[model samples]
Target: MSFEVDIGYASARGPREDNEDFAAVVRPAPHDEARGLIAAVADGVSSGGQGRLAAQTTVMSLVQDFHGVPETWDTTVALDRLISAQNAWLAGHNRRRSGEGTAMCTLTALVLRGHSYTLAHVGDTRAWLLRGGECIQLSQDHSFDHPDLRHALSRAIGLDDHVRVDYSQGELHRGDVFVLTTDGVHGVLRRRELAARAREGSAQAASEALVEAALKAGSRDNATALVIRVAGLAAGRLEDLLLRGRQLPVPPKLRVGDLLDGYVITAMLADNGVHRLYQARSVATQALVAIKALHEARASDPQERAMLAHEAWLGSRVARDGQAGLVRVHELEDPSAFYVVYDWHSGQTLEQLIEDGRRLDVSEVVDAGRAVLKPLGRLHRQGVIHRDIKPANLHRGDDGQWRLLDLGVAVSGREPEAARSLHAGTPSYINPEQWQPDDPVRADAGSDLYALGVTLYQALTGRLPYGEIEPYQLARFRRDPRAPSQVRPDVPIWLDHVLLKAVARDPKLRFETAEEFALALERGASRPLPAHGSTPLVARDPAVLWKIALVVSLLFNALLIVWLLFLPR
Candidate 1:
């Protein structure tokens, strides 16, 4: 949970009129540190006459905009987007100011995040690393080695509209040191000489020493160095941890007495052929926990492994980032095999409550609903869609707190390709739009909210508003979902209006945001909304309407015949 790092940067104009070299270390606030520590160095292409502006712009944009991207975006994707935009702007600016020399620079950026480091380079200002007393060059210069072409760069920012950037990544370790330098510094000092200075003292001191050494060595160009020392290794990406676990060979079927790491399996929670959930207790602390592992038969399946890995990351983030309303995912200490651990709460699923015929009243259902809305809103804003939202995926603790569960089928925009294609939410809870062949927006925040409405309606009425749909059936959403009050007479009219709007057949008719739905719930009867959940008699039940019409017609004809026959004409 600790993010320990040291960063320092130094720059000098040297013998030049302006210091075109720029170096910066952007250490975000503690809450934003998860995006990692960023250090960037840029050496301006001085021959172009606008190097200073280009260098400053390149590094400054990254420092300001990196964490502004959605957290669900992959690290590579986020960096690529920011760099690409900046490059395009600089390229366009060069055209507009044709007389002004083109703004161009060589960039090298480093991101130390989680337990790994991502490096992006273009016409490199060089990057080097020192670990365990060994120094290694981490980047290759884009300039030619031939003396005539040495001054010409094959690639650089603002050189052209399109730029091909080289990206690389590797595991990070404590005590690892990263050094970024412009040509003026590395061009004169030997690799070992540069490493010697970087190893001297603190990050700032080392950076200063590198620049001073470069100047002392008689380099004419502007010089700069950025040093980053890893004081501690943070948690690795969830995907990396799960991949390592996947490679460890799944442990055999565990019994009640089986011990994994320090936790002992206490009971089999559920076995659904694909996965096995078990209740486990920590031997040291005697704390209860839940473990989800692949079925032995599915040990070699790659798709399943990806799904479980993504689920772990998604659920873990949602629980950790928010105040409450979700079950927390726990990290095990050097587990023996692939599995996900969750902090177990003593509770029964909402599915169990409904199955037990414990019908929820208007107030109880509202409270249960408010508990889910907050977390649901958080997930949507984080760029995650919980495709599967149902009573079975909701848990109510003995302490009376409701928690949303099971993100196995959720989409976080970074899921594996195979996982992305699989539509795996429960059939009964799936919104009607996902079944439409023409509907473009299949499953999204609106879909989740629709499913939630169905769940609360079921909780109150003990029946699905649209009835239980079987898997693979082309759901003919020929009619709108029934109102809650219609199914359960005791349900209030205001409750009926809210739940109906949530499960409306036309997705646009449904609540646009979780906040909106929650507002209606909180307002209760005080500010009841009146839109449409009301369908015409014919659409609701055509056959029943026809039957009543036929009966009325027969009775009217009988009365006509009796009056004609009995009266003296």
Candidate 2:
């Protein structure tokens, strides 16, 4: 169950193409003898935002970080780190160019170890396995249902507010060939054609052949392909794999007994960027608690330092406000060069709950809303706007309650200091007014209501209210989205109305405050639930329809056969 690999990449700008559609290769780091590999293909989103930059950054970062990937790394963590880093970089880059921001791009990255491989992807760029004279697709295309699909990518790096990557792991066998390519290749060359190319020659040759085929087939975009041939098995070198390359700046090592401020460091949560969340004891009462240390490097950076400070202050504000639905920030203390102290409840993030495949029943969504809206209402009353309100920030406690986290981007009206700072938040959940250049009233209550609407949409339909769109495309569809009931029929009508109003694109149309929104939702939930209607006319008796359709098909075929076999003869 182990093997070395042969890697090669081939790319071509097709007839109707201008920008290169394909970028793929394996970076060989001399320092890391771990034999790590990074194979990626990015299809630049053609509309705007330096798509090439998005592709190049994604590929370059993955290659640089591939050598140090953890053996026991969770795909979720890897994806989060990759996309989050890219986003911060993109955000900074975008600030320089008012309208020339980097364009989003589809991404597929693979890390290989002996015979095992890990894959992560967004959009339509894909990975495939060619074995036993057959080519099997290993990735699904994130595209809308359409005849041609075109350049519409469901997910792309640096495009949307957040990148949600689909990740998977698999075993590699000797003689098995893996192909990674942008849409130009698979969208043009058929699977049979790819399989034929895989059987023709070495990995390098096969890669070239596939790209050529895509060009011959009139692929109208940049075509890129990678061929990886499994050579043979070798020893598992997990540690060597991650530590061999260019030195990664390591944070100071922490120990269990080390005390900073009033909190005690327990253990390291992760390797990079100092994810040392500690179990600290209260100095006043000797009660155990949890705290997180920000990376010293990040703390030293001016922008990051400001964010850390803001996070600490916001945490304390929420706690002092006595909001039941937010993590209580007891006090701001420099546990280390960078850290925040908060009263921690043992609970899972909303993301963790979703990952656990736990569906939020209607009552659960309501109860969770009650928890979230109350704290939000409190913050609003204090003239605080939590710009980054989303599921990842929602923590579900053991007491069957939910809470908010990381209000670093929060805006407090009373603070002349905060009022001067510019807009900040995850774009997917942000209100339009928050993103505006000019300062509007920014009803803290109104913004919170909008986020609650989005949360409800996600809770019921398992999808975003406005669907996925690139950053540049945001302006095109700024209006309120179709109601939730249209997207998910089973959603209660009253709840749907409540959510729609909360997320209404027009502030004038949305609820006046979080409390008001909560009241409306509560009323919606209080009404008697309706039963699902009877089966539609088309579905009432499928058997009758099937029989009628079958008879028609049979008669048509019989007539065609008679024409060919008897009448024509």
Candidate 3:
């Protein structure tokens, strides 16, 4: 696939001094494997002694040293190597200025190879993806705190002798858009708007639009934007060509080893209370793979067996099209074992990316919505409901495509479809209808739709539609949620209304299905929603505040009184 990229960057000495010390560089790599594209963004630490020098030098040196990356190695390994190399360069640079260096800036670098991407970052600068009408953040801030910080970064390229650089890998698909920006651009634009703008015309235009939006929103620092769009894929399938005729359950455990068919188990990648994911390899070609299995305890329980079967069933259905966005599952040979096998993927989960506290641009959030909803739409069409859709379950693959995991089995018990009860899923991300005990486990795409809304809201605004509520409190979501934009003014008004509708307390008021909800979100970026539309319960009534306060006070008083009465008397 021939790749096309466009970048727009602007810096304003906004409301401040002359040194708009931020600097960025976009260069093509020399290696054929890399398809050779590299971009870096640096924000000079306004307070640090040598902020400008640190940023400029770091970005420039990174671009120069990038050619040294081994073309034979995987992108993940290469990214780690680059971060180490750059940090080392900065360390020596910092030492030379030792007593003189006062300012410290952050660095974020991106490397594109064929369709894959490797990202490394520091501070709050961000990287995002716009694919299938959604905007998805691809990097995390190394900041020490959330919202904003009054202090310098906890770690910068030159601040420490050795910096623990966190990085991840992802694949880029045709129409996939990537953005890199300083806090100046992100702090003001939000992810939904960024994603939407990225889609408007070219990457260059998107970059310009982002900087203008940030400036308009009152950015106090120098602002910059680097936009890269994956215009087309090379003529062949990247993964398919890399590993062919691979078998499952490689030499290791079913989900852990490479013995199942041709797939080889690399390592256990992730585990929650219910399932364990394994990073595996292809036995035939030694390709990296990801395998997912149910927890042993859940698999052992007779009640959970059916749920496990249902989960595998749904995985098979979704992967029937062999969409890279959805994980591949194997049919159980014994049907008695407690695990399912899946293709391994390398990338950050949405939860990991959001921990940086940076919100995604509007276009990025919408791209994410589409990535999730496209497969979800396929699942719904086939009568499958991914009861749980959250950052944790959504996987951004090495190919840059988004994949959904742990389908059908929100809780470990039975076929979610046949059950007439609301049983599983995480509270913050679960849909409103999922709270109805009488609701059937089947065709609740509305529930999934609500989850999609919550995911999009969190991605773009950096806040949940209902804020943070306890699991038991989810039952109260029977009412609509507050608009996301209201919670965070920078959130585009269109997104605020769309998310609220998706998570509408009443399923009737919510998007009827994943498809319907996705359409609204996809188009909502370009067109704002009507302000007079239905409002969510979260914003409509603070009456619950009084009730909640009374309850909290009562609990506190009760506890205090009990303590006093129990005292020696």
Candidate 4:
């Protein structure tokens, strides 16, 4: 499958002394086709002193910055962040040149990713979709209501410190046409007239015709038109993704001195039943790295292969912008086998550190929690949930940084439908609700917090809070486990309360977000601690209270029966 498009644009100064409109279409390289094509148009505020610069910079920045974002990010997320940053830069520039006047502009952008189109708009510039011989407006004009002030924009880039961009998305099909225009063009031409011109000629000719029509219709402002016609679309099927994974054969029982691609295997790190990990060195750079590949026994399984590919995809998206601890995945150059290569780091697994009797001070624990939660927070913001977060999956580098790892069971907002019975995460660390049959509440950021709480508890005291739970056994969370302070005397009372709240059995009782959990941990020393045994037994351990009630009732009934029998004639 392939995604091919035809793009055309035309700009006119019209009756204005200077043209303040800009537009562009960005085409990705062969390797970046998955990121898709982008079309953007910006119209500068005519009254502003730097109108032309504003329009040019807005369009050019979007085209360049959008592609720089991580491929794993959803189209909406990537666009939102890029636009917000651009707005900040424009606003700051205007402030720096106080007397020079503001740099303000209206923007509309369209992204064709996979099988859908994402539209982002601000101010009066408009976006439209022409299909089935009908033209439909896809953007809302941010202008005032009063007739005298109708031309005044209520929202535009560089107008404020922060801008609210309108966003929408819909599925795409072949032959769909996307149109963008500044107010100068759209305000002058009627919808029907614009549609007629768009359907009359090629995309380039149609764009030029639209601009000419606006100018002839007495448009006093600069006019610009951009047209995009979808020539073809790739299937974007699961098989297409699997084919990429299958480009190279699975490595067969790698050993020391073995060579794959340009990397030479130096030592085997781990060989779990499902996958193998090796420490290798690059032949060209002589840099040490880690290579992970699926086990030969599971290589043929579609599910396992899909998970491995997804792990690589998810990792690539979140490792940018000073996000430390996560090792970036390197793209292979014509590899002969299927595997993932990661930048090697000299680090020790959290599990190994705990087993080696390395004690962490409260300050260190707080810092670690903050480090891990930062990336988790980023994932949640992107509509992703890390289902598996445990000691073995966290690495603490010698540089005093902690990074979360292993997104094998991660769930994204765009995840495909799967069976509800599929197991997720390790049983021992999984939230109690996750173990319930047909559980309605799916694993989320809160669930990740529960697992993190367990890890923290284990690190402080070399024991599981509720004991290890077997996979098939019923997970009973009705008993209140010993608090962290009780298990480890050095643990502060306030810190223990924070951990208890994090691991609460009911989802509602736990922290609602990673940020809240991290804040609680950071401020543990300053906050007031709850009184010992403050939680009601019924709330903490309902099952135990119910048993005691039953035993008491039975004893009272027996005594009453005996008293009546002895007194009766």
Q: Against the true structure, candidate 4 has what lDDT?
A: 0.81
lDDT of 3 by residue, 329-364 (tens): 653322223455666667878887899665566676
Per-residue lDDT value at 281 in model 3? 69
Q: Which numbered prediction scores highest in lDDT against the true structure? A: 1
TM-score of each: 0.64, 0.44, 0.45, 0.58
lDDT of 2 by residue, 470-549 (tens): 43344524444666678767667777667776766666777887777777767775763233332333443335678789
Poorest lDDT segment (10 consecutive residues) of candidate 1: 471-480
Q: What is the lDDT of residue 558 in candidate 1?
A: 94
User: In model 4, which regions exceed 4 Å deviation?
Assistant: 1-241, 414-421, 437-440, 472-476, 528-534, 540-568
Residue 211 CA displacement from its true place in model 1, Å? 6.9
Candidate 1 vs candidate 2: the TM-score winner is: 1
Per candidate, the number of residue pairs that clash is: 0, 11, 63, 0
Ranking by TM-score: 1, 4, 3, 2
Ordered list by lDDT, greatest first: 1, 4, 2, 3
Computed on alpha carbons, the lDDT of every model, listed in order, comes to 0.84, 0.67, 0.65, 0.81
Better of 3 and 4 by TM-score: 4
Better of 1 and 3 by lDDT: 1
Q: State the lDDT at 334 in candidate 3.
A: 20
